[model samples]
Target chain A: MAIEKHDKENSGGGRPVAEKGEHIVARHLIEDDNIKEEKNLVIDGVDVSGRWNTFIISRVNSEFDRSFFEEIKKTVAGSRINRCWQCGMCTASCTVTPLYRRFNPRAFIYMMQLGNLKELKKYIDVAWRCVGCYKCSQRCPKQVNPAEMMEALALVIKKYFPEEVKTKLKLDEEVKKIYEDMIIGHGRLDLAKLHTYAIQKSGRTKELLGKIERDAIFKMVKDGRAFSVLRLGKPHNWSSSKEAMENYLRKLNTIENTEAGV
Target chain B: MAIEISNRLGLANVKSDYIHTAGRKLEDIHERLLELEAKGEVKVIHIKEENKPIEAETLLGWKKKIPTNKLWHHKSCGQCGNIPGYPVSLLWFMNQMGLEYVDERNQTSCTAWNYHGSGTSNPVGLAAVAVRNWHRAYELGLFPLFHCATTFGDYKEMRNLLVENKELRDEVRRIMHKIGRELVIPEYIVHYSEWVHVMRFEIAKLKKYDLSSIIATVHPACHTYKMIPEDCIYDKDIYAGKRTAVSTGVMLALGAQVADYSTWYDCCGFGFRHILTEREASRSFVMDRKIRPMVREAHSDVCITQDTGCTTTLDKNQWIGKAMGYTEQVPVMADVMFAALACGADVFKIVQLQWHTTDWRPLCEKIGIDWKKSEEEYNAYLEELKAGGKTVNLYEYPKS
Candidate 1:
């Protein structure tokens, strides 16, 4: 069976519609099937697969997916990901495959081109395992960024998966709060207290409660792990006065309120 | 002074700007050399063949191996404090070789990691580290031996100051007096690698086993390479020799087949501050380019290094790469590979040396290292590492 190239003009041109300081041309050109084949979808002088047109059209049609495909296409066009001719060099050069046979970088790109989001989502967790070593990208024959695509796939997973997104967001919020407290409140580290506060904020209350039953938590309690956490290192005597603290707090509150759109 | 301020703030962007400025200075020096060549003030002689007299005895000469009576050891704070076994391994190696070395607790750390990473580049701090270390060596009646490349480079700067500025010595003395410290000088301050290389014959006596089949590569620490180029004796004929000079030279001399590959001299991505602050950039340099190619393609079993920080980057960061899905695990070790071979340590113990500065028990057990007969101190250290569990703040602490 002969492969049929999907017409991307029906969705939108993958390229930018307007050039800088130039008038926008919204006119759509209709072409015959022969003319469509003659028009090259060459990226970086290499003809891309007809599958990319189908992928682009599918993305443009989804109500919430406006410009999502365009953003990915821009990255692909910029980094030359679509220029890949399915050369197995990247997969062969990849270090992860030898160790983890489940990780197939070439298959990932193939699935991406086919617009297989279900298969892609299944391997979303594997993307984080990429050390950004760039061996695949560096050795890529077509200069496709398998690493960047993996990162992009991870972002898509985080966006679509609500439960996973919530857990990660909570962790991020807790970490940010700790960082804010360190820089704004103390201006230095209090190792012991930081550990206690981190545990408390992370909802390890069950673990804290378990300590009461197990008797394993005695060393931590009696050793003043709770009280002395603030005194693990040299105490910084210098701190903002009450007036300065209030001023700082007001500025912080303003920033938070602005962030919350209040 | 501006550099110092940038460093204290842990501003990597500012640090790189200074590095670029230093690069420009080197370009200026190259321009001067070209200008001198053009002027006819300097005569350049290229002799195709100049016959020089070589003494018959010198060709076959062997120096008497004397047990090193005393050594003034310079400390790497990052390794000595955090990766405790780095100093311990060096001491163990020295003792096994019957070298008398003193670990002077009074000598403050070189502090080069902080100063250099911060972009402060304080000549005073570098000089203090040198003078203090040299004084410790003098008190112990031993030549100063530096384990870290930063300490070696600092001492080299101090040597320059001693020769070029008498007033600097007085300033050093004044600072020492204020700090209530003694100021001792050294006749010779050298890197540990250099000391080991020089005593190759003595080291040969200690090699009880051979690993000539195991292919190895050396990652020469950048501070050692760039700071004092003359002191980097290993990479001189790095590409030309059967084995690259420094890491391969020591390994080859101890009977290991060293593989020659591209990027042998590349930085291990532990550019002190770069590894700590700009982790992605640092890991990119190592995982993307160096370690992955050596392990996966070149098929080298191990990569050896001299500097403590370089060893840590190559070894500990292997896991980071695995977690990140960058590469398969490849064992990274130190020049202590030779020390392990010398002491008749089993392959397990040699592999254990892979984590010379950190906990090696997990690695040792993986490789089947029998800890039962090993020293109690080693076992205790492993236990501490297992229980004391710590997390690194990759964003907060600059890599050293």
Candidate 2:
């Protein structure tokens, strides 16, 4: 274990700067493959006319139209991705990868460079779990925002996947409802009401009610516990004054507007 | 609704009386076991039972075990400046417990508050702050002791960087080396609660006053909960036994009725920048989101928090809520309340019970704490409140 830990520390060893000529040669080889693929497709006369093909073409065109590649280049201007030399220091250092086998920071960058959107979307959930912790970002030999890139990929998934977007929208609405209720209800929380609302939104109200009843019945029938132990009720003064409620609402509005960039 | 039925019965909402009865039966059995133990029906092995106990020298030692020397002191700028007595209280407690530790002025604020709030400040800035503070501890030849969770977290981040990024580690070291310092990660970096709890048995010797009636609630800070789970040592079942993460454990040990409430673990929402830049969202999270529910549902007389930031969010923001029109005043205080209680001080004066809920002056008077003492007496009380010693003038601790 000690030897392995030591090896992990010295894994990348140090920066390995490639010669200018070697980088140029590698770039030409990549470009040559692109040309060869285009030529083969033309000669074969095989029509790649499908939904997947259309999606790929549209994604490529969108990137090309706004020079999205240039934006990415600017974001990682200080990064040493070009000098990466496939060191795998980032993957080794990433905490997320240990939990999520599919999340490979180095592989994601490589795929992004090749414009592989379909493959990127597969790990959208993994990206959303970044938590902006910056452990991976700090450890990156290339100084890449692996977490940010994951977030971007998650965004892309949200954009392209309609069902995911709808689910997210519903969750956001539920969150907003909680915010609104608190603001309008007198700058205080109504726990019972909030729990009820959350349960109803999640479509778990019936199940939750059942669980409560089962526990209460069991306690009464088996151990003869006091009935008072199961009380779940709203406070007497459930609502706040209109002015106080309004102030909270105003604050919520300001928060929403700020978050929305309005 | 079924909840109404449960509420009428004064029980936690559950399916039927069966489970509640079973739970009660289990409690009865547990009580019987305790009874048996008390009567010597159950023989318990013990290393030693003392016929006579030694006298405690300090007020802090009354409730906290003190190590003669080693302490992982986590730093907290907000508490140091705003509630200056909190650290002073700990220092006094340490002295009372005969613990030896070091507090270095050269250490910078964790800066985690700023970084967590604004994405603009990168890990490098946070790591830099951590390295500088750790270097100060190294210079003192003492382990770093962090009072605040953010400080502990920032140091943890620095430790990660040192382990993972050679370049970043080298950069941090170089920066410190230029200032004629070498940053050393402590063998242990801990929250103050953990330190106190670790010494609970010894500290139990100093309890002169009984505090069993004061109903209290622990409001664990989000940063502490999320950043360092291991440091929190509270048991969930026994409200009083719930660990240091919530700051209720010591309260429980002191004989306070620890209330169990939903949203007990919610963030007080004092993301420093959130309060300054996004005041509304911040206040909403605290007043509307966190405190209100706990106050109404928990049946707690006071809510104790560890972080000065959390305390300010819940304490100062209560006035903001009042101005906004929320009438429910729930007093929010710090673990200093526990320290105060342990010192045999009047509960109302020492706990700053007036700060708990708005309009608590009447409550303080009702509780027999003199609310209108002379300025000198008030300052002395506050000094004693912080130092966990006899009351002294406030200006004794030099201003930085």
Candidate 3:
């Protein structure tokens, strides 16, 4: 579904360029979206024309590695990965699927179960994009809990493809700061603050004054909800709770980083 | 609660009171269940063949069942903070029904929010917190009923891990021992909605509001239905061989008009961290999928849910939608709040509609409620509360 780019050129007075390898025999055998074919090109003063320079990227997926599936099965979250019969209920009810077609939970679970990490590797850009909505788990007839299964997928990807994740999902520093502050300071989340801060941090402050944004602000203010946020600040007697949470977070971060070894 | 076992089968002669078939305790089956989970067994359990509903009933209590003697009311942070009246309405109703209960500030939040959304706490820390909270309940001779569905699923999953896995339990025990609490899994852990469903008929008789005219829809919280479908109360209509949703059980009891709509089975989209990280996606899910459908398809007047998270999501998102220039706003309230409102509890003290973001004036007009007077009385009561005098509590005395 990611195929989009195309360059067209009329050549030889009547010959069709057939850009994107459409004229290649058994076109389905190659990844059409990824096919590399130049109508006319010169490399090192060589006449790389006609069929000489045309290249069809290999579309054939080989080696269904069950080792990754075994590794995933060992995890508590992905233990039920085998229950997916590819009914697509997970994909159907997925909240993120509607927004991003590549973030398909059913397909991810299938790839994880079959150890098709090569095929899955291509979608690394959208691999960790499950919003963790748990809608898939609810609608799944097999009780697959594809929601946590997504967590398992994320864990496996982080373990196997750390660099890819790092490059693809560039962490927004401002969103990270807002999250850290909200969770640590209050032992709770102020979604409104976090959302506004994230929008501001992303240099979208003008959207903050957009018609929808302004209308939402007025409505919240009119209903006393905006003021309620100040009154309902944080949990009372939260010093010890806060201490426990902070200690736990520190230890967890240490363990994760040590495992990541970055 | 009245479970009939075949007297001829001599189940009574068994060593334990728990029903056993083929000379095996239910815990033995649970142990095997743990093994199946470990083995990654894909075979769905044939309810009639291997372990029937009776087996699950042995682990989770029976239908029409609740502990009337005393209860350990574990307050949900989302409910106490966001809804403000949800937990108190539950306590208020329980006390009215002559059910002795304890609500302690000593008990902390379930700490499940992190595990689901934020990668904050580890498995051991969470197990320790859960056991610590329930151990206090056990000390008080009470069963714990969590208000949040996520907490219910968290407790169930954590308790299973603690009960089945020795290594995790030992780790948790070390933490609990330091906290001066022991790790003994409660016999029965449930969400508060279960108790409400079992007593729906009793609630129907006490309801003072004629709710027949109002259009209502229910969002059965995803965790409550999905986590342990066997544990939740089942209605023939809602289940239909699929997962049984609990809020509909509440609607059936209150004699409210049940609006059939799409997105009824969908999650409230409060993906804990999803909302924090992907606010746009979360908002899209709640508005386009949930709120808009309830408006267009069901013409829903009020959306009732028992999950504190779902309540917060559905109720709060309507306001967010209104701010975004979508005028169709539905008031979302906990099912117990609906029941309590129908039972003639004070709209201010019990329902606390002012704390809600979505305008509920339409619902008020539909229900023939005088919001202006209720608002004034609520303020006066707040003043009285500040002055250290007992204001009129709607259910202060036992409802005789």
Candidate lDDT scores, in order, read: 0.53, 0.52, 0.68
How far is B355's C-alpha from truth in model 1 (Å)? 4.9
Stretches of model 2 off by over 4 angstroms after superposition: A1-262, B1-74, B234-246, B323-325, B345-376, B379-400
True contacts kept of each: 0.00, 0.00, 0.00
Write model 2 residue lDDT over B1-400, tens digit each, in one string.
4463234222211122111112222222223333444754332111111211112111111121123244436568777656555666666566566655655566677878777766668766677677677666655555566788677666655555554565775677667668776644443344565555445545556766555555566787766656634323433223323223236546655665566565765678777666665454456567666667666666556767777788777876665453333556666666654555455444433343433434545434433445566335666766877888765442222222
Candidate order, TM-score descending: 3, 2, 1
- Give the alpha carbon lDDT tens digit for every residue of B1-400 in model 1: 4453323222111211111112222222223323444654221111111211111110012111222435656777666544455566556666665555567667777877776677676676677766766665555455666788777766655655544455765677677777665654443345676655555556667776555455565677766656644334422232332222445456656765565445666788777776565443455466656777676555666667888777777666554443234645555666764456444554332234534423444433433445555646455556767898563321121111
The all-Cα superposition gives candidate 3 an RMSD in Å to the true structure of 30.7
Interface RMSD of 3: 21.3
1 versus 2: better lDDT goes to: 1
Q: Which numbered prediction scores highest in TM-score against the true structure?
A: 3
> What tens digits encode model 2's per-residue C-alpha lDDT throughout A98-190?
888877777766655655665555555454554556676677666665666554444345545546545645654465458665645445555
Q: After superposition, how far is residue B172 of candidate 2 from its true place, in Å?
A: 1.6
Cα misplacement distance, residue B354 of candidate 1 (Å):
8.3
Worst 10 residues of 1 chain B by lDDT: B51-60
Supply DockQ values for each candidate. 0.01, 0.01, 0.01
Q: In terms of TM-score, how similar is model 2 to the real structure?
A: 0.46
Q: Per-residue CA lDDT of candidate 3, range B313-387, in tens?
A: 777765444333356778999889888877876678778878898878788778877777888988887888899
